[model samples]
Target chain A: DAGITQSPRHKVTETGTPVTLRCHQTENHRYMYWYRQDPGHGLRLIHYSYGVKDTDKGEVSDGYSVSRSKTEDFLLTLESATSSQTSVYFCAIRGLYGYTFGSGTRLTVV
Target chain B: GIQVEQSPPDLILQEGANSTLRCNFSDSVNNLQWFHQNPWGQLINLFYIPSGTKQNGRLSATTVATERYSLLYISSSQTTDSGVYFCAVPYQGGSEKLVFGKGTKLTVNP
Candidate 1:
C-alpha cells in the first residue's frame, strides 16, 4: 500500500455550497493528480500538480480547482457544487513504476 | 490529447473463469498503466506496462506500444475482482497526465 489517504471519505452537500476534498501522501512523489469517476464517463482528470505551486487543468476542469502548497498535500475544491459534480473523486501519486491512488472520496450534491 | 478505448464495456464470469480486457490508444504514449477499482471504489494499480509483459499473482498485463494496444489478463477470477478495470496512458512529451479509458465493468459470480 502506498501511504496515501483521502480525507472525508464521504460527503453530502447541497448545490451551490463549496466543497473541498483533500489528498495526502506520505511518499515524496513529484506528480499528483485529481480525477473524478462518473457513470459512463470512467475516470476523467480534473487537475494535476507536477510540483508545489505548479498545477494544470485537465479536460473536465471547468468547475474545479486544485492547489498543492506542499509535496504531501493536494486539494480539490468545487467553488459551488452542482448536481453534476456528484461523483467519486480519486487522488493519485506517481511512482517510477506506476501510480498509487487514494481510497477515494464520494461526494453527493443535492 | 490522446484517445483511449477500452473494449467489452461490461463482462460477467464465474469465479474460476479466466478473462482478458483490452485497451487501445490512438497515439503513441510514453506511459501505460492498468488499475482495478475495487468494490469500495478504491483504485489500485495493477501494472505499468508501457511495453513488454508483466505479471502479479493471477493478474498479468502486456502492452505492445508498436501496436498501440494493451491487454490485461485475469486468471481464475475471484469475486473480489468484480469492479471496474481502467487503462490510462500518458501522451508523449506531456506532463505525465494520464488519459483514461472508460473502463470495463467486470462482474464475477461465485
Candidate 2:
C-alpha cells in the first residue's frame, strides 16, 4: 500500500460536469499538493495545502479548487470541467526526504 | 518567476550503461527534489538533495545550491529504468509550491 493514494484511478466525464478527485494519505504530512501532467506541460501545480483549512493557488489553478478539511485528505475539484482538462493528476505529500507521490488519477473530460 | 531547466530532453541507452541528467535553476531554493515517473505513471521520489551529495544503490544525486544546479546519475541502467526523470524546486524562496522542469525521458534497451 502507498502512503499516499488517489481515488478514481481512471475517470471519463463529460464536459461541463463537476468532478471531484480524492487524495488520501496514511501519514499526516502537513503539506500536500495537486499537480497535473500533460504531454508538453510536464507537471504543473494546481493547488497546494500547507495545513488543514489553509490552501493556496499554484501556477495552474484556473479551473480547479482544493480543500483540506482534515490533515490526511486533500481534495481537488474541477468546476465545469472542460475538454482541455483531460490529463493525469497526481497527489503528493512533502516527506522528510522529499515529496512522495500517489499513483496518478487519469481523468479524461470528453 | 524562477526558471527550472532540464537538459537532454530525451535519452537512449543500452543496458548496463551509465547516464547523467542535469537540472538548472535560475535562483536558489531551499528544497530540491528528483523524481522518477515510471511507465505505469507512478511517481517515485528519488532524492532530496538541497546541497551536497547522496547515494542510493546505483543512483546518486548532487546539488550545488550556490550554482543553482543539480545532477542525477544512474549507473548500470536497466530496461525497468526506462521512464521520465524530473527535477523540482520551490517556486520561489519561502514558498512550499514546487515547480517542475519539463523532464528528461530515458529509454533503456536490452
Candidate 3:
C-alpha cells in the first residue's frame, strides 16, 4: 500500500489478443519494475524502468514490453497474449528502505 | 545474474510454532530482501536486510553476507501467516533488479 495501484485486478482474455496492464505510483520513486509469479518459478523480472522514458529488459522480457512515459505511470503490454503468459503480475517501486509492491493483477489467457 | 535458492520449499506449522526459512545466493549481493505474499496475493515487504539483522513484530531476518545466505524467522506463527515467503537479491553493483528464489510456501493451521 505504498501509494502504488494496479488496474484491472483480474483479467481474462483469449489468446492472440493484445493486453495492457497499468501501474500507477504516487510516491514518484525513481525505479519501477514488472514481475510475474508462477508455480515453481517464483517471481521473474519482466522489465524495469530506471527513470521517466528510460527502461530496460529483464530476464523474462520475451513476449512482453514496458513503457514509462511519466514519473507516475508504468505500463506493461503483451503484443499478442498467449496462455503461457497466464500468471499473477506484480509491479514494484524502489524506495530507500526496500521495494513496495502492488496488490497484483491476475491475468488468465484462454 | 545472481542465482537465489530457498530451502524447505514447503512448510506446515501450527499456531504458536516458530520456523526458519533460508535463502542462499550464488554470488555476492549488496541488497537482499524478504517478502511475504499473503493469501490475497499482495506482496508485503518484510525485510531489507542487506547485512546484519532486523526484526519487526513476530518476524526477524538475519543476513550473513560473508556466508552468502539469509534467514527469516517467524515466531508464534498464525493461520494468517500461511502464504509464500520469498527472498530476493540483486547482482553486485547492478541496479536494484532482484532475482527471486522459488520461495518457501508456508501453511499455518490453527
Candidate 4:
C-alpha cells in the first residue's frame, strides 16, 4: 500500500473511448496484479504480471489487457471502455509481507 | 482455481463490539490473505495467514487449511472499522495470482 500507486484516482470517460490505468510501485516486487471491484461481483482479477514482460490473463480478462515492461510498472488498458466496465480498479504487488494494494482508481463510463 | 465464499455478507456492529468473519474455500490452499477495503477504496492488508493463527492489535485471524476455512476476528471495533473485508487465495499452482471472495461489508456505528 505504501509503495504501490495508482494514477488518476478518478476518471470519467465516454463509453467508446479507450482508457488506460497506470500502476507504479517503488518496491521492486516481481509480481503485479490488476483487479476490479463491483457491487455483487466483489473483486475480480483482470490480469497479472509475474515479471517484466511476462503477463497472464485472469478470469475476467476479456475486456482488459495489461503490460509490464518494467518491474516497477504495470498498466491496465481497456481497448474500448463500456458502461459495464465502470468500476473501481486496484493494483497490487506481491511483497514479503503479502500482497500490498494501491488506493484504487474509480472509473466512470457514460 | 479455488472458490472463496465469505459469510455474513453484511454486518452491523456497535462501537466497542466484537465480531467474527468466516471464509470458506472450495479446496485446500496454503496461501491466503485477508484484506480490508476502506470506504475510500484503499485496500489494506490485515493478515497473510495461510494457516495457524496470528493477532495484531484488536484483529486476529485463524486459518484451518485442512478444513478449507479461515476466520477473522475483530475486537473493540470502532467506526473506522466500517469497510469491506476480503479473503483471497491463490488461483492455481504456486503463483501469486489470487481469486477473491465477494467480500463481507461491515458497518460499525458509534
Candidate 5:
C-alpha cells in the first residue's frame, strides 16, 4: 500500500506478444522497482528507476525494459512474452519509513 | 549481491502458537525488511528493521547488522498469518535493489 497501484491485475498473453505493465504511485517517491516472483525464486528484480527518465537494470533484466518518463509513473515492458516470463510482477516504492508494494500483476504467457 | 538464507523453509503451527523465523545474510546491509505474501499474492511489509528491534502488535522484528542476521517473531499466531515470509536485503554496493531469500512458508492451522 505504498501509494502504488499496478494496472491489469491479471493478464494472459500469447507467446511472442508484447506486454506492458504499468505501476503508478501517488507518493512522489524517488525510487520505483519491478520484481517478478516465481515458485522457487522468491523475487527477482527486473529493473528500477531512481528519478525521472533515470532507470537501471536489475538482476533479471533480460526480456524486460523499463521506462520512467515521470516521477509518478514507471512502466515495465516485455518486448516479447515467453513462457518463462509467466509470473506475478510486483511494483514497489521506496518510502521514508520503508518500502511499499502494490497488489501485483499476474501474467500468464501461453 | 548479498546472500540471504531463511531457516525452516516450511513450518506448520497450530493456532495461538508462537514461532521465530530467521534470516541470515552474508554481508552487512543498510536495510533489512520482512514481508508477508498473502494468499492472494499481495506483499505486505511487516518490518523495515535495518538494526535494533521494532514491534507492531503481534509481530516483532530484530536485525543485528553486526551479525548480519534478522529475526521475526510472531506471537499468538492466527490462521490469517499463514503465508510466505520473505526477508530482503540490499545488494552489496548499497543499491536499492534487494536480494530476497527463498522464504519461509508458514502454515497456521486451527
Candidate 6:
C-alpha cells in the first residue's frame, strides 16, 4: 500500500534458467525484503536490504540473491531456477509504522 | 533470531462468527505486525501493533510485549476474510528483518 510494486506478476521458467523479479517503491524506503511463500513452509525470508548496495541473507537465502542499486528499486535474482523455487515471491518495504508488501510475483519452474 | 508460532493452523466459521488468532514469540519484542494473505496471493498488512491495542473496523490486535505474544481478533468475519493470517516479529528486537509464523488459515463460510 506504500506505493510498492512488483513486476512480472507471473512467470514460467525452465530449470537452471536465471530469473529476476523486481520490486519498486515510490516512497524510497531504506529497508526492503524478499520472501517466498510456499504451501507448508510459510513465508521464508530470502534476502533483505538495509540500504543501497547493502544486503544480507535471510533464513532461506541459498539460490537467491538481491541487489539494491537505488533507493526505490530492489531486485531479486534466482541464480538457477529450480522446482523448489516455484512459489509466490513477495517484496516488502519497512515503513515507519509497519511493513508494506507488493502484489507479489508467482514464479513457476518447469 | 526470534521465533514466532501461531495457534490453530486452520479454522472454519460461519460468516458473522468471531474468532481470535494468537501469536507467540520466543523473545520479547518492541514490534509485532500482522498480515492477511488473500486467495489471490496479495499480502495485506493488518496491524503494526508492537504493544497495546489497535482497532480498525471489525479487526483489532493486541500485543503484550512483556508476555511475548500477540492476538488478532476478528469480529463478524465475512467471506472475504477467508485467507491466511500471519504474525511477524523483528529478527532481534528491532532488526530490519522479520521472522514470520507459518500462519493460521481462516475460512469464513456463508
Q: How high is the CA lDDT of each candidate model?
A: 0.92, 0.94, 0.93, 0.92, 0.94, 0.93
Model 2 clash pairs? none
Q: What's the C-alpha lDDT at position A18 in model 6? A: 96
lDDT of 1 by residue, A8-59 (tens): 9999999999999999999999899998988888888899999999999888
lDDT of 4 by residue, A1-110 (tens): 57889998999999989999999999888889999988888888899999999999887998898998888999999999999999999998889878998989999999
Docking class of 5: high
Cα lDDT of model 5 by residue, A1-110, tens digit: 75789999999999999999999999899999999999887899999999999999998999999999999999999999999999999999999867799999999999
Residue range A9-90, candidate 6, lDDT tens digits? 9999999999999999999789999999888899989999999999999999999988999999999999999999999999
Computed on C-alpha atoms, the DockQ of candidate 3 is 0.93
Worst 10 residues of 5 chain A by lDDT: A94-103
lDDT per residue for candidate 3 within A1-110, as digits (tens), equals 97999988999999999999999999989999999988878888999999999999998999998999999999999999999999999999999999999999999999
Task: List ranges where model 1 is wrong by over 4 Å.
Answer: none
| DockQ of predicted model 2 | 0.94
Share of real interface contacts recovered by each model?
A: 0.94, 0.97, 0.97, 0.91, 0.85, 0.88
In model 3, state the lDDT of residue B34: 98
Give the TM-score of each candidate: 0.95, 0.97, 0.97, 0.97, 0.98, 0.97
Candidate closer to the true structure by lDDT (higher is better), 2 or 4: 2
* Candidate 2 ranges beyond 4 A from true positions: none
How does candidate 6 score on lDDT?
A: 0.93
Residue runs of model 3 more than 4 Å from their true location after superposition: none
By summed lDDT, the worst window of 10 consecutive residues in model 3 chain A runs over A36-45
Q: Which DockQ-derived CAPRI band holds candidate 4?
A: high
CA RMSD of each candidate after superposition:
1.3, 0.9, 1.0, 1.1, 0.8, 1.0
- Model 6 chain B: weakest 10-residue lDDT segment is B90-99
Candidate 6 — which residues are off by over 4 angstroms?
none
Q: For candidate 5, lDDT tens digit of each residue in B72-106?
A: 99999999999999999988767788889999999
* Candidate 4 local lDDT, B6-102, one digit each (tens): 9999999999999999999998787899999898888899999999999999999999999999999999999999999999998876767888999
In order, the interface RMSDs are 0.7, 0.6, 0.6, 0.8, 0.8, 0.7
